[model samples]
Target: MEEPVRWGVLATGKIAESFARELREVPGARLVAVGSRTQASADRFAAAYGGRPHGTYRALVEDPEVEVVYVATPHALHLEDTRMALEAGKHVLCEKPLTLNLSEAETLVALASTRGLFLMEAMWMACHPVVRAVADGLRSGRFGAPRQLHADLGFVVQVPPEHRLRDPALGAGALLDMGVYPLTLADLLLGPATEVRATAVLDERGVDVDVAVAARHGEAVSVSTASMTSASPRTASLATDTGRIDLPGDFHHPAYAVWTPVGGEPERIDPPEPVLGSGLGNEAAEVGRCVREGLGESPWVPHARSLRVMQLMDDVRRQIGVRYGADAAGVAT
Candidate 1:
């Protein structure tokens, strides 16, 4: 049997904890180490998740036993954290929105390519079984030609002003945090976006709290909305020439989808394989497969696709007047 892929998790935040829990469910994967700014935080995570705890990210990435590193820091820290792991000669799976802007994302991708190491954006939704099946069906003409799509995700964020979700320095915003999901879902089901237009409501700090986006992907049009100040259905639906498909609430990691033919009754479509855990583990499984197969990037979450999404978010941010530190440093918005 193939040896399990050894893993190290950097950071001990809520997302990191969630990934740790899901990582446990991925076959051929093992949690070897976890790192945090403080020893207490690392120890706590390790104790709960079964890993060796390191007080510093540097230590965790340098752990000889760790073959792949999962960068679970906030969006603002992804570039640096992922770059560090790549420089240390470890494969990486970084959290979504990849980086603050397209330039930073390019830098990381170039680095990974130069080093010939595996690098992938942790867009868990893209690895979801239900999503893949639906996208495949759409592409294969089993669902007919996709015409239009609409997806929305939102929640009233109840956190202090200093919290990451409300802080500009931390790359906090509804668009980056919640909006990426809807946009990605549309891209997968519709194709690469060719034109994008957006509008948003920003907080006092100039961080977007609510955002709505419309884009044209080939001949199909898609609308996506995300908000941090209100609750939404968090649903997605795709209209095609012959039928329609809908994903209920929490569409990003749905267990199943509903499909209705033009003149046929609605049918439920389940994923081809069992979901690992809360859907996140499926991405872990993808990483393990790629690493063992000596592939530098996951075909399911290609580098080009991740960069395209980042570019779209950049355009949206520019139009909405939400700027990050990278933008000020002359990074293309």
Candidate 2:
């Protein structure tokens, strides 16, 4: 039997917890350790998830037993944390948005390339079965040339201003936090966006609360919306010249998809595998497979794709005037 890939989780936030819960679902994957800013937090998380707790992020990356570290830190810390892990000679899978902007993302990608280590942005949606099926179908002309698309993800966050979703320093914004889903879906279904136009409502903290973006990819056009102050359908659709594919609610982690060919009845495609704690296991498994194959990046979510997504997000933010301090404090020269 193949050896289980040892995993180290950085941060003890909700996302981290979810990743840990889902990690068990992947074959040949193991959660060996966890790191947090505080020993108390690490201990608490480790007790629940079954991993050795480290008091600091540095300690966790430095551990000789861990093969790869999942950087689950907030958006603002992704670059710093991923760089730190790569420098420590450990492979990394950082959470999405990857970094606050494209510049930071490029730096990390170059670092991982230089170190010849595995690195991937945790964009689980791209690894999802339904999304993969749709991507394959699109590539094979299952849905004739996509003509237009619309995707949205939103939820009402009734939290204090200090909440991460509302705090600028944490890279809080509808675009970064929630919008990436729809934007990524569009990119996957259509192609790289050739033009983008965006408008947003920024809160007192200078972070976007609601955002809408329209982008053109070749002859195809897409509309993406995200919000923190309101509820949206949390769905996505691709209208092709010959048919349309309707992704179920929370399109990012959809349970099923409906493909309607022109003049034909809709077909239901159920998810192929049971998702663990929101389908994160799929991405985790992809990372493990890439690492085991001695590959530095997963073909499913390549570094180039990640950089492109960051670049598009940067453009959207520029139009919306939402900037995180990290934009000015890039980690790489």
Candidate that would win on lDDT? 1
Estimate TM-scores for all models. Answer: 0.98, 0.97
What tens digits encode model 2's per-residue C-alpha lDDT throughout 153-204?
A: 9999887877788788888888988999899888888889999999999887
Model 2 residue 175 CA deviation (Å) reads: 0.4
- lDDT by residue (tens digit), candidate 1, 1-333: 999999999999999999999998999999999999999999999999989999999999999999999999989999999999999999999999899899999999999999999999999999999999998888789999999999999999999988889988898999989999999888878889999999999888898999999999999999999999998899999999999999989999998999999999999999999899989999999999999999999999999989989989988888888888888776534
Worst 10 residues of 2 by lDDT: 324-333
Those runs of model 1 whose alpha carbons end farther than 4 Å from true positions after fitting are none
Model 1, C-alpha of 182: deviation from truth (Å): 1.1
- The TM-score that candidate 1 achieves is 0.98
The C-alpha RMSD of each candidate to the native structure, in angstroms, is 0.9, 1.9
